[model samples]
Target: MDEIKILFLSHTVDYSKAPYDTGNQFIQALRNNNAAYLSYVQLYNKYGHYGAHHYLKKYVRDNGINCLIYGSSPSEFYFDINYLEKLRKEVFLVMMTGDTEYYYEIRDQYYAQAMDLVTVNDFISTFKLRQIGINSIPYYAYYDSTKYSKNGNLAKDIDVSFIGTLHGGAGRWHNIMHLSANGINIETFGSDSPNGRITFEKKIEIINRSKINLDFSGVSGKTRLTRKHQIYKRMKQIKGKVFEYTMCGSFALCEYAPGLEYFFEVGKEIDIFHDKEELLEKIKYYLAHEEEREKIAQKGYERALKDYAVERAVPKLISIIDGLRKTKTYKPSEIYLDEEFIRNYTTYRTLLIIRFITQLKFKFAFEELKIILKYRKLDLYQIVIFFKEEILDMFPRIKSVLKSIFRRQ
Candidate 1:
């Protein structure tokens, strides 16, 4: 077979600029295997949607770009479905769902028809998409082994550390505060934390320096504190930090999430906790037993290097992509076009608009409105729901009564 040329498209220039490093690791892994002539474009940053569409079409034509991997959601770029469909004929289009829990219904499913394959970050999401007849696969987030290897030279000064955001409704702040109250000194570093966010270099250093690295696998819903948001905050999924912690040779005590055991042997390779009490108890035990903690950390590091490295996973991804090209059996689902489905999805979208407006993100709310109008005309029911939510914000007691009435039905 001929070499597969790839074009990696993302919203940011590179990994350093990106909020997450998953895309960069994938790009690096492709290069490591000498797969093909790979080119990268930060479409949104370089050009606006219209300009990006024009440039992308011309660039793909001028250059022999056979595969295009989009790292961001279709909604963020706002690419026309027709434009994507036309491009699909020429290239193997793959879309990556970074936050599948929230955006899969609102954003991803709408574009799955245009994609040759959709790569979900978690296992449950992959299964969900396949059930709906979309060609999907679990592309577990991997770490750059070259950059995140075990560093024995660093001193383990910190007791426990968490290197992610604590904002939104994930309940991370509550957990951290609980641990602190119980005398577990956690050096927190992320948005909304006392220390604030750290640099990429600092993150690696902190992970290695900390005796026990902490991970919260739960998903954060909308910033607004709603019943739905509260439910979402309790939902768990495999986190990218799981690989990062192990790759850095740090003993991780991650929050228990389903499907985590498939990747690592719990209690042997890495540890997990179900609640704040367990997390606190485990932290104390591990801190006291140095040798046991070191053994688990070493095992996790070996496992991560062998199985979860980006270099190791990219070949499998390439094979899957190649096989997909040969078979071409994937059929787009018409479920997104169903009237009842559209109505439900629109209701979800309106709730998101309310979320944005309440959070003072007027621009995002306006963009969501545009997306809503593009597909289906706004109806009286949607308008009523929007106002009802707004009024509910004013009268909490009345809102609670209505919430219970709806739940019982």
Candidate 2:
């Protein structure tokens, strides 16, 4: 097949502008292999939606881009009816989301409606999307082996270490405290930790130097989002830390989560823990049996390079894109807000209400809001914004409620 031109839209959170971003990694792999004509536009921490849509359209036309790879949800991008209508006819939109726990509820509904295909990092997330009639693919995180390989010179002196968020109520601190009390010494790193803001290079170093890299999904259970949904099912998705530590030649003792079985043999290539007691047991067993830990780490590294590296994964992604193009259909730029679509996807509908309220011209906004409100389904934030915008024109009851709120304030 001829080279497929791709425009990657990355939702970057880190302000450091690291070169090892997931989008950059995919781009480099494609470029390195002479696989495709690839370009990227980062959405977050940089451009507003209008600016994003402008550049996205320009790049699609100028480059004759065949595919657009969204690193997260399309909601993160500044996509409107005009851009959606124009680009859907030209480029196949593909979404690659790792954090299904957060995105699936709020952002993914937009992805479900907008994208040609959606690829998630876990099987559970993939299955859920497919059940909703989405063309979803199950994919795992890929790291560059050349950048993340183990250094023999770095001493594996640290027995246990974790290098991500310690807060946001995902129960990392609680688990860490439990393990610590049970006699496992884990060196913590990240912005929330005392070690603080390590570079990507530093992350690789730490991973290589640790005997057992303790990995957490960094999802807090106490959050309102989780409480409102099936929290356990969300946590069933695997984290990128599994691939990262494994590629760095460190034995990963990850918390029990689904999706690991698809990549690795749980007991042979990696280990998992359920609670403090189980974690402590595994840590003690692994530490005492140095040979076992070394074997698992070695197996993980081999698996990573052979099967999970970006070099290996990108070709497959390109192949999928190529296949998707062969079967591509010319879809009109219609904003999908069908009743069944709205009823099935609360987050998508809620986002539509907000986007309609906040993004459209004023003349269009009121009419759109009234239609959405008549639908009788909205999130708390959307409702607040609705009242604040006076979309209801303060019906007698709503006016009294607003008056009471103001009196309290």
Screening candidate 2 with a backbone cut-off below 3 angstroms (N, C-alpha, C), the clashing residue pairs are: 49-78, 169-220, 170-219, 170-220
Candidate 2 lDDT tens digits, 232-351:
434544778889988888899988777778888898889998777788899999999999899999998888878788988888777877798778786653355544335333433344
Tens-digit per-residue lDDT, 82-121, candidate 1 = 5777788778888887767755655677667678889987
Best of the candidates, lDDT:
1
Lowest-scoring 10 consecutive residues by lDDT in candidate 2? 38-47
TM-score attained by model 2: 0.73
Superposed model 1: Cα runs more than 4 Å off: 14-22, 31-62, 74-77, 221-230, 329-335, 338-409
How many times do residue backbones clash in model 2? 4
Against the hidden true structure, what lDDT does model 1 obtain? 0.74
How high is the lDDT of residue 351 in model 2? 40
**Candidate 1: residue 322 lDDT (0-100):** 78
